[model samples]
Target: MTDASIPSDGKWIPQAMSVKYLAKAKTALRAVASGEKVDWDTSGEKTVPVEVFDEDGQRVFTAEITMNVKLN
Candidate 1:
């Protein structure tokens, strides 16, 4: 997560968001051994929780974003 930047027009421009996954298993080891050249399978969608806080450290809003996930 990153802080938003305000432009001259008084609009907040937030940084690009992304998702990352860490794997530690046989499948992961195989993928690594293959130099990550294996086909990926769609696992499913996941909901990521987000929270917005004000300058006073108070929770102002909360939200969730759905993202598609893949597995090797």
Candidate 2:
């Protein structure tokens, strides 16, 4: 991931980016879901909030990204 700044406001935002960036994001997600070790640059945070969206452009759920994320 690049040095993109996450918005401080708690709002769901969509970002426009290159296909390469999308691919990289997907790879990172896949790695995390597939039990691969992920080193998150949280800057000393314990958990990060991640919202998952569905195909209908709706948020299905939110996840807490942490070091002890259950692999699998």
Candidate 3:
């Protein structure tokens, strides 16, 4: 995975990407459902950091993903 950062000028600056496991899926899921207020302006969409690892326990990549939840 390629890592990059954007400045106020709005440009794609590429950087080196690294990975480290912060928590397991269960832990992350619990945190997401921790009863935080939704931001309507974003339509309940949230970005979370995730890490991918290989079967041999090797780190693959890390990235942020957007999750959308629909409420009844």
lDDT of each: 0.33, 0.31, 0.37
Once fitted onto the true fold, the runs of candidate 3 whose alpha carbons sit more than 4 angstroms away are 1-43
Worst ten in a row by lDDT for model 2: 17-26
Q: Please report how far candidate 1 places residue 8 from its true position, in Å.
A: 38
lDDT of 3 by residue, 1-72 (tens): 111121233322223333455544432222112123323233344444555555556445566554453332
lDDT of 2 by residue, 1-72 (tens): 212232232222223321112111222222112212333332332343455444444444445443321211
lDDT of 1 by residue, 1-72 (tens): 211111223322222344333322222121111112212223444444555444445444455444444333
Per-residue lDDT of 41 in model 2: 30
Superposed by TM-score, candidate 1 places the C-alpha of residue 21 at a distance from the truth, in angstroms, of 29
TM-score of 2: 0.31
* CA RMSD, predictions in order: 18.3, 13.8, 12.8
lDDT of 2 at 29: 28
What are the models' TM-scores?
Answer: 0.39, 0.31, 0.34
